[model samples]
Target: MKKLIAIIPLLALCACWYSFTLKPYPDIDTVFVDSFANETDRFELPSAITEGLIGELHSGSILKLATRERAHSVLSGTVTHFGSEAYTYTAGEEPLDFRVTVRARVRFERAGADSPFWDYTVEGFATYPMDESTKSESQAIDEAVSMLISRIMDRLRTG
Candidate 1:
């Protein structure tokens, strides 16, 4: 009977953890994110990458921090790989058609005694007609990143 009583406490302690709890997209107190580390030998990556992500997080209203050190979560990432083939004509071809792919990833770290650590990754891509202008291509990348972050937040809400 004493052993059974002791085991009861153990079982309760084990149950305290939640592997699949629908944690409300953690109300991030603050988040610090790392910029994309260039890994491609091709074009130079944009500098606004970090700023854009910061803007996304701000828009999402997930977390706010006066400084990176004060953030409860830290976000960082490396430009794993990026490349794209001409979906249609390469360039200077009549009725030019092409697709530019921007692949980037970000991860988040949260510190909490009662909350489980969480990591989120997001990627996005956009395609437009040729002659859409470089700005458009750039916009596509930002949009993709934005979409990815949104999805991550959505996942947090559900899981």
Candidate 2:
């Protein structure tokens, strides 16, 4: 009788854990990530952001990558803004660093669904020091892109 009681509690714990770990999009098997629309004046920003997101999706392996026609869901995004501002100054009053920020509206929707699964605006920032070892504009943009991708994934996984 004691062993049975302990086994019941263990089974209950397992059930609760399983339910907690269940993902919302279990039926979604494939995704298509579209080229992002660039509203910013920066050249190649859209391609770079799109490539970064595709890289993340490929690495995650949570969803298979597919062409738009074969996808279970499609993800589209628009770069609403991107800019860099001087963040720090050198001791001689020279520009020491700059912070780059990018904001985007992202939508992930199921194929043929009435509404989007997720729609939101996400922003990311990175600081680039303007020194001998300073990163270039592209590097700063890459960092921001990665940050934005991470935020999107977190929201998707949790919600």
Candidate 3:
């Protein structure tokens, strides 16, 4: 009973601290994510990137989606590269697994700003086994996109 009472106070204090730190970004409410330009020949990659970023920002619950004219900030980018490599091979010299990497250069600019506040080349990769694994190349690409989106949001929030 004594230990439980001590824990209650600590838990209450933690809750208070958490609420105090839950602050949103200043001077920004909505964002516009432009359709990314695809330098590679991958079909529909530009649409995929745009949708992925919108989904992420919405799910993050920190920013509202807006049109280009109404946005307080804009995010634009290009999918610069994407490729796969045979990562694991069987002793018999057969391919057993693959690793896929996706790279992009992103720019985030605030409204009326002359220069972007965040501009970076970000990358994400995933590895999957060949036959027995249920994961597919499409799924790997989705995972990499999610990773890239998360990293971009992290940079925006931290910066």
Candidate 4:
């Protein structure tokens, strides 16, 4: 009986710290994700990143997707880098694997605000075998983009 009574208080305390939903931005409920500007040679990155972000926003309840005219905040970014380099080499110095990396400069701001609430850079990478039959560069790029989306989501959640 004593242990049960003690657990009751502890359970109540734990419940107080629990949240049913995420409120990423307490003051903003809807957001407009702008088409990312591509600065890298990879011309597809802008649309890919933008589409990935939209899919993420749709999957999560943290924020509602809105048009710029109706949005309370804006999320914008620029794809600054995209490249691949040898990650693993054979005994003879032949490339066995490569790492594809993507980087973006992102900002989150309130609608009509002169300054953003947060602005920073996020990067993601993925490795693939050199053999195109097993895994292709396109697959690695997709993985890197997924990782990038996850990092962006993390930033939004924490900020």
Candidate 5:
């Protein structure tokens, strides 16, 4: 009974030592994400990234999705580069795996602001086997897109 009482106080103390709140963008409660501009030859990248971001925002509790007219902030980006290269090769020089990379220039700004508060370049990549036994090129691209979205989310939450 005495040990339990002691642990109770210790647990309460530990709980008080840590607290979490998602107020990363304190000034902005709602955000509008725009369709990313595709500078790469891949025509589907912009829409894919844009839709992925919207889906993330819609599912997350940190930021509410809003229409452009009702948003406190706007997020836009340009898909600057997309490419796939050989990642691994067998002893006979046969391709074993490939790495797909995607890069974007992202901007986050207050609504109607003249300049963005956050402007940065973000990159994401994923590797896939040549055999498609595990993952295919399209799946690798989707994984890369998820990685890119995760980085963007980290930036929003941290900055």
Candidate 6:
């Protein structure tokens, strides 16, 4: 009889905690990053951003999903817009370089969560000289976008 009373209070406490505070999230494995949508004509990037996204997700024990239904989280986003502006870059000694400013909105969410959602914009600028090699330019842009996704993951994991 005494055990029943004790168990009742224990269950009540568990229920209260569940109702009041968010549970700790385990690291999610699979994520789907869909292709860029709503892309514009000028300064357009390839549909290959999806592949870049998946490669980034490969770090830290995460897996990329081929289908949305199989993933633990679905990261679907519209490009909304990818805008760029030219700026003077004065990096090296001889000649001043050029710079491009890039901006995009990335929306993220867990598949089953009802209360919380992630929606934000990440902006960054990269500078390259007029005579910069093609490989260098590609690598620079890849780093910027990868950094943006890392920040998004950190927010989702902690928030």
The number of the candidate with the highest TM-score is: 4
**Residue-wise lDDT of candidate 1 within 1-159, one digit each (tens)?**
999999998887777755543354456667676666766663444344566666766775545643666777766666555555456664566555445555555555674334445544455555655677654666655565556556655553454
lDDT for every model? 0.58, 0.85, 0.83, 0.92, 0.91, 0.58
Q: Looking at model 6, how many pairs of residues clash? A: 0
In the predicted model 1, the residue pairs found to clash are: 32-75
- Model 4 regions lying over 4 Å from their true place: 1-21
How displaced is residue 8 in candidate 3, in Å? 29
Compose the digit string of candidate 6's lDDT tens values, residues 17-105. 87775323455666777675646553444353555566666755335564678777766555444443344545654544554444557
User: TM-score of each candidate?
Assistant: 0.58, 0.80, 0.78, 0.85, 0.83, 0.58
Summing lDDT over every window of 10 consecutive residues in candidate 5, give the lowest-scoring window: 16-25
* Model 2 pairs in collision: none
Model 2: number of backbone collisions: 0
lDDT of 5 at 33: 96
Candidate ranking (TM-score, best to worst): 4, 5, 2, 3, 6, 1
Query: How far does residue 142 in candidate 4 sit from its true spot (Å)?
Result: 0.5
**Tens digits of lDDT, candidate 4, 1-159:** 999999999998788755644565688999999999999999998899999999999997588899999999999999999999999999999999999999999999999999998999999899989987678999999999999989998888878
Residue clash pairs of candidate 4:
none
- For model 4, the local distance difference test gives 0.92
In terms of TM-score, how similar is model 1 to the real structure?
0.58
Best by lDDT: 4
